[model samples]
Target: VVDRLNLQAIVPSAQTLQEQSSRMHLKKLKTVVTYWATRQIITYNVPPLAFIIAANTNVNTGALINLYSDLQKVAIEDLFNKS
Candidate 1:
């Protein structure tokens, strides 16, 4: 991991990294994008959360984390049966 970090730092800049990322082979692109989207919480885990999200705007991040936790608290019955 340390070696990877060192090599990553050697990349010239953000622009260079963006260019290099295209060339880099990914074993699991979904895993990479999942992390980029914060374990998919900020993307699709909770539908309400996904609907209202806005970028480049200031808001309390803690509330989002708590909200995600609250939504994740599903009962077993909620999981097993549906209409």
Candidate 2:
């Protein structure tokens, strides 16, 4: 196996790799918040365009968005599990 590869792989620092993971988490957050917001809009009988506009503009979905954004900021990976 050693002789098969001619190129070296670049390994990024954990912090840099964590940034990518953090972005993945933030995207998951947005999807979840959108789900909840859709439920609320259904309850309120608001137009569907309202959700589209707010999400495009990156407007706050009240407390849930704030809380999840903070969660994404502070999240860390488990030492033993890569997932």
Candidate 3:
């Protein structure tokens, strides 16, 4: 569906709503509030354009993106071990 709509980037900003750890509550508050603010500003002030860039993700997602590789010895061995 996204490809059909020609949407290049789908910021999962709201994905932060899933944060459930007490340790991450503060960070979640910041992320949700920031996303809301940006959404409001863009919705009322500036309209979407062809080349506009946006981002959306929490710590886990951010770290996943930054990870260079997921290849692992255990993963490879498991793949070959008919389970």
Find the candidate with the highest lDDT and give its number: 1
Per-residue CA lDDT of model 1 for 1-83, tens digit only, reads: 64555533332443443444455553223111111212222222343222123222244445544554455444223545552
Q: For every model shown, what is its TM-score relative to the native structure?
A: 0.29, 0.22, 0.19
Give the C-alpha lDDT of model 2.
0.33
The sequence of per-residue lDDT tens digits that candidate 3 reaches over residues 15-51 is 4423422334544222222243223111111112111
Model 1 residue runs over 4 Å out of place are: 1-41, 44-52, 74-77, 80-83
- Tens digits of lDDT, candidate 2, 13-67: 3354346546646423342222222232111111221111123224455643445
Candidate 1 residue pairs in clash (backbone atoms < 3 Å) = none
In the order shown, the candidates' Cα RMSDs to the true structure are 14.6, 17.8, 15.1
By TM-score, how accurate is candidate 1?
Answer: 0.29
CA lDDT, every model vs. true structure: 0.34, 0.33, 0.31
Query: Clashing residue pairs, candidate 2?
Result: none
Q: Of models 1 and 3, which has the larger lDDT?
A: 1
